[model samples]
Target: MTSLDMTREALARAERESAMKSRILATVSHDIRTPLSGIAGMSHLLGQTRLTPEQANYLAGIGQSVQALSQLVDDLLDFSAIEAGRFKLHPRDDDLRQLIESVVEILAHRAHEKGIEIASWVAADVPGLLSFDPERLRQVLFNLVGNAVKFTNEGGVLVSASMVEGELEIRVRDTGPGMSVRGQERLFREFEQVGEEKSRIGGTGLGLAISRRIVLEAGGSIAVESELGVGSTFVVRVPVGQPSDFRLRQARATMLSSTHMLIIAPDGVCREALAAAVTSLGGTVRLAATPADLLASLEHAADAFTDIVVDRRLADFLSEELCKHPVFRNPATRRILLIDPETRSTTRFLGAGYDSWLVRPLRERSLVGVLQGRMKGIELRDPINDNRSNSRWTQAEGSGLDVLLAEDDPVNRLLLKTVLKKGGHRVSEVETLRDLIAAATQATGRPGAIVTDLSMPGGNGLDALSAIRDFERTNRLAEVPIIVVTGSAGSETRKAAIDAGATELFVKPADPAKLAELLASYAARRAG
Candidate 1:
């Protein structure tokens, strides 16, 4: 055969092999991840319980492992995208500090086990919002910090971010055994783990390599500085920008100067942060370091402070104290609580003593809105209070969703039903395509959402999906959000499900938290 013909044939084979590999990986990932969803979902539910510190720690470990596994699958998918030159960048205004904090918080569990502190600091001059692909940035941080925690056996990982001349410079420094000059040369090469240290620390070794690619794709430079025993630092510099109208937040914050707020928080960092958030509101802020100081301040004229925000440390213990305190009992005194999502249940404090609670790490807008609304005497449309759909995922008992679930396996069906029911959804279980048809065509009111499995005894999920679409068109029925979940994973099956009218498709091991969020969004949209 001619050289060109042979080369063409080889290229064709490589393409075919790549396609098959992608298909196989997708199926395997679905099979593996389907069960992980249950593990993650149940773990989340378990975390909500009043467990001991030991039990909570154990649950946290499980969560970290699951998260790590999820990231592995994501990395594989991303690698494929890069190879195919199909990696799409979606840039929008994102809070860079929040993104950095989220990365650190998620990996904090693993670091804690090794006695390594994950600390992060964003420069004071950094913009409140910057345009970037949050997912890609998250991927980069996840890989870099995750590796930092793995290789480091000593002090910790410190993430320092600053904007210099319109470029975001992020440095991930770790007090671990560092790589040599020769090792640094091959560090960012695909699947290359330089040292024996990396060998002992388990990873696919695609992390740093993938991170480098992501940085380069974002028009950024990623470089490393290291010595044999002095630990290593990964440096990344990317363009930082914001949307055209960046002053709207500042404009709103300008109005807070007329409002007086007494801010109380426990940790010095959090206290300063919360105080800064209040200051951004253009308000007069008096920060109290302790509950005692807050109480002393409250002892003054009730009107002295238009608003009082207690720390998470004080919210739960103050219900009775609030009733007894004359200043607190006054209806004009607006009280807000800075709360932890996992530890402090916001519902318990809301209406108990607090006017509203913002979940930590606190968002400036939420703080400003509560303070401003109170100042204007404009009744706050509490997202939770005004709309059940807003809190449906966390507080699902009142969502009132009529849900249709189709699954052939009794165990899977029961699991789905239990989760949906617990999530305040009225689920109608059907095991076959015939049953799905019956449920869809019946004269009764249609469900708010439908969950279906792809493969079943009576017919496949796509068959049921097609039937639902036809029925919707024939009867001019309202489009209900349909989620297709199946163990059978393939491009054809996925495309078919989408074409036949599935709103979302998830492979098994799909996190229930994600499903809950999706359902909540749909419910909120429909309600609105």
Candidate 2:
């Protein structure tokens, strides 16, 4: 063969090897997660039962262990996929503020346990809906924040994201013991751990390595800055891909133009974030470091401020005193509290003369809406507990629909069935592709929804989905929502499933809570 022919053959061989590795990894991942899902599902069910404190601790331990194991498995598979050139990015349009808040929420428990605060903020200029892979981006944030929380003992961690130039810049700053120059140099190396107390902090040490690779693959850069006695900050900048439907909505949302506000935030970081948000929306703002400062500013200023935004910590200190003040007593001036996420209730604020509240690491949209009196305080409710009384869920549960579930594994099938039953749905179980197609096409009445696994004994689930879709079209029947819960992690598998008419695809082991929520939504949609 010629040199060019030889090179082509080599390239083809490498592609084939990568494809083979991808298939093997998918099978392995699915097999491992299938059983993990069973454990997780049973754990969820077990927690719902009444138990002693000791039993609850044990159950919690099991959950933590399972989560750790799952993370390990995922990390190993993700590294292998990256090495084999099989890693893929799934980008979608989602709110940047929501993404940052989610990361903080996930790590809030850990930070609280350590007696430290964790918060995030997104600049007003950042578009609400940015095209990015949330899952992958979140993974990087998790590693950065998780490490920061693990090391920091006294101070807190603050994460902020902004649109700088044409890139999205994410900054994760932690008040932990600073790292040495050598430690920073070796930070991104695979399986290398370096820090002041490396011995005390236990991890696979693959997080930063994987994160670096992910960022580089996405045409982004990750860097760090630290000093011996000071803390550290990890900054990641990625190219921002605007969605096809992108618009400068935030720039156009100047409804707060006529609003004048007095802001009081003791925390400098939070105060600046709030001020930026307000001004970005065309509102005028004056900052105060304390209640006295706020009072002094109000007393001297000739302008009648339309709004008063104060942090809950400061408000708690002098709520009564501030409420009695002449300027504070002005009924027209809206009082907005910057509440910490852990504040379980808002009733105390009402009694303290506050009219509205906004959660910290404030989003620009929420800030604008609250200033314009177009939005209400966001109430943090427990989803599982609230579902019992939620009108939508109640309506769906009161008159459940027939749900068809397809899974070759008995354990997964049983787990899914239990979850569906708990949601008040009647389920018909099928194990093979042939049976899935038959049950789906031949049912006397249309199923409320169908949940299936991609890999089946008799045939491929995608093929079954295709056949079912054809039958539905041919018979002029309404299309049923088919949710795919599989172990496959290949992008090709996800693409094929979507192309074959899958409504939603979840990789195993799917959270029982999320799966149930998805089912409930479909039922509710149909009922509506």
Pick the TM-score winner: 2
**TM-score: model 1 vs. ground truth:** 0.67
Identify the runs in model 1 with alpha carbons over 4 angstroms from their true place: 45-58, 109-116, 121-130, 153-155, 194-200, 228-230, 245-399, 408-412, 432-438, 443-445, 454-467, 486-500, 504-508, 517-528
Best by lDDT: 2
Cand. 2 Cα-lDDT: 0.79
TM-score, predicted candidate 2 vs. hidden true structure: 0.84
Candidate 1 clashing pairs? 33-508, 33-509, 34-508, 34-509, 37-509, 256-282, 257-282, 454-461
Q: Model 1, range 297-328, lDDT digits (tens) per residue?
A: 76764456788788767665655666777777
Error in Å for residue 36 of model 2? 1.6
Off by over 4 Å in 2: 1-24, 47-64, 90-94, 196-202, 243-260, 268-272, 282-302, 381-398, 443-446, 470-477
Distance from true location, Cα of 383 in model 1, Å: 24
lDDT of 2 by residue, 1-528 (tens): 999999999999988988787668766777898888788768776776677778866876777667766776777788878888768788888777887877777776667667776777666567768888998999899889988888888767888887798899999988888899999999998888887555435477788999999999889999999987678999999997765433465554465678888887775446766776667667788888766787788787778889988787777676666756787889888888887666766887766678889876555557777877888676652322111223232233436768999988888888888778878898888889998898899747767799999888998778899999999999899999999998775667789999999999987768777788888888778889
Looking at model 2, residue 309 earns an lDDT score of 84
